[model samples]
Target: MDRISALRNVEDALRAFEEGDVDLTEAERRVAATLRTYASELDGEDDVFRAVGDPAVDGRVVVAASAPAARERVLAAAGIDPDRIDDEGDVPEFDVERV
Candidate 1:
C-alpha cells in the first residue's frame, strides 16, 4: 500500500484501540507492534520507528527522523516486508536565522 494508505491504516488501528474494539493488553499490543513494523517499513533507514515499551496496554512507540523522507524510509525498512512507500507528504522547512 502507499504511504497515505499505510498512515490511514495506522490511524484506523489507533482508533480501534481508542474505542476498545481490541484488547488493550493483548491484541492492541500486537496491533501496535504491527503498526510499528509497518511504520518502519515505510521509513527505512532515514527514520527510526521502534516500540519503546512493553507490548502491554499503554506501551509507547516513537517515530522520528532528521528528515521527513528519512522518516518514510524508516517505515520502508520494516523488518517485515510491506507494500512500497510512495513518500507522500509535505516536506518540512528549515530556515537559519541570524542571532
Candidate 2:
C-alpha cells in the first residue's frame, strides 16, 4: 500500500477506537496489519520480517535479505550489541519470521 493509504488505514483504526466500534486490542491489531502491509509493499528485493520470542526484540519489523540479517537488524534497532555479550544469556534470543 502507498504511504497515504497506510495513513488512512491507521486513521480509520484510530477512529474506530475513538468511536467505541473496536476495543484497544482490535484497533492495535488493525493498525499493525496496516503497517505490515505498507512495509511489505515498500520492501524491494528484501523481505519484511518480524522478531519474536524475546521481549527486547519482539514485534520489531524490518526488511532484510535473510532471517539472520533481519534478526541482526532487530537487535541493532533495540540497542543490543550482539558482540558485546557478557555471557550466552546476554544475547537476546529471538527468531525472525517473514511477515
| Superposition TM-score, candidate 1 onto the true structure | 0.30
The clash count of every prediction, one per candidate, is 22, 0
Top candidate on TM-score is 2
- Summarize candidate 1's per-residue lDDT along 1-99 as a digit string, tens digits: 456765677677778778888656755575566666665566353344333222221123334545444333333333322253236632222221111
For model 2, what is the error of residue 34's alpha carbon versus the real structure, in angstroms, after optimal superposition? 0.6
Model 2 residue pairs with clashes: none
Q: How many clashing pairs does model 2 include? A: 0
lDDT by candidate, in order shown: 0.45, 0.89
Quote each prediction's TM-score.
Answer: 0.30, 0.70
CA RMSD, predictions in order: 14.6, 2.6
Error of 2 at 16 (Å): 1.3
lDDT of 2 by residue, 1-26 (tens): 99999999999999999999999999
Lowest-lDDT window of 10 residues in candidate 2? 85-94
Consecutive 10-residue window with the lowest summed lDDT within model 1: 90-99
